[model samples]
Target: LSPSTGHRSIRTSSKPRPAKPCDPKSPCCRRSLTIDLDQSNNALDFVIYPRQFDIGECIGSCDTSGSSLQYTQAKNDQQKNKPHAAYNLVFLHHHGRNNNSLAATRNHRADKESSRCCSFSRTGGLELTYTTTVNGPIIKKYIPNMTVESCRCGLPATIQQV
Candidate 1:
């Protein structure tokens, strides 16, 4: 994505690819994903600015070896309630045990059973102005969480059987 305008790139001849595949030890990260709204195969009739834009995607394998500390910086003016029509995020959490009891080990094994996936940690959006049909009325829409800002290895469920 463009650092200046926060807009994505226009279409190019060749698409970008990751240098190498991610492994279990690799950190979950973001990769550029350029989307062409006007691709020949697309069934839409709108002309979008930043014709080709990067929404990005998550890549890498989730580390299942040992746990580590994660710190999050809170926004000073974070909103208590998000704006209307915002995307809802579901986060899976691991229940860590302090003791290494047999039951704890069993729970840990169960936790491992639930594999983690590379997922979005933070996200933003872009405003898209398009017409429903060719020469149709122009509409401007702000899509929330349409772009991946950061990524992490996370569980996919809100509840886990311990």
Candidate 2:
């Protein structure tokens, strides 16, 4: 009997692979940054930087039981000792109230109410209104061969691809 020639011969092909570095400089490496302004459980302004490929722009008003505004920037700089490629700008305004009573002992109950109302008016009825815009500048030094795009917040978003 002929030695097992029944097994089919396997054939393989070798193709040359493209040469390229995996970590080419790109916006994909940059992190999204955000800034927020809030008051009495309400958001006044929320803006995202590098708006392209991200959500950006928020405007509203809130009453002040108490209010707070905060700003933060985040980005991934692959190279050590390099500053983040994004920045955030914000402007905020707070309102002040007036007091009606200054008497020391004109009916203790009435005095208490007056003080309470004064303090309450200071922050209990705060109104915050604003408009927000985002601008993103290309960090050419980071990605030499690509252009950055501008993006706005909403459905059916658009992005300029490099």
Candidates in order have lDDT scores of 0.49, 0.22
Q: Candidate 1: minimum summed lDDT over ten consecutive residues — where?
A: 69-78
lDDT of 1 by residue, 11-128 (tens): 2322222223334556677666566766645664475664776666565556455342121111111123222112223222223223558875676656653445555666556667
lDDT of 1: 0.49
Number of the top-ranking candidate, with lDDT as the measure: 1
For residue 100, model 1's alpha carbon misses the true position, in angstroms, by: 28
For model 2, residues 1-162, the per-residue Cα lDDT tens digits are 235886543212111112122233321222222322322123423322222222122111121222212111111111321222221111111111122244533544543322221010000111122234344432212221122123221211122222
Off by over 4 Å in 2: 1-44, 48-78, 81-83, 87-130, 133-162
Could you give me the TM-score of model 1 versus the true structure? Answer: 0.50
Which residue pairs does candidate 2 place in steric collision?
A: 64-123, 64-126
Error of 1 at 112 (Å): 5.1
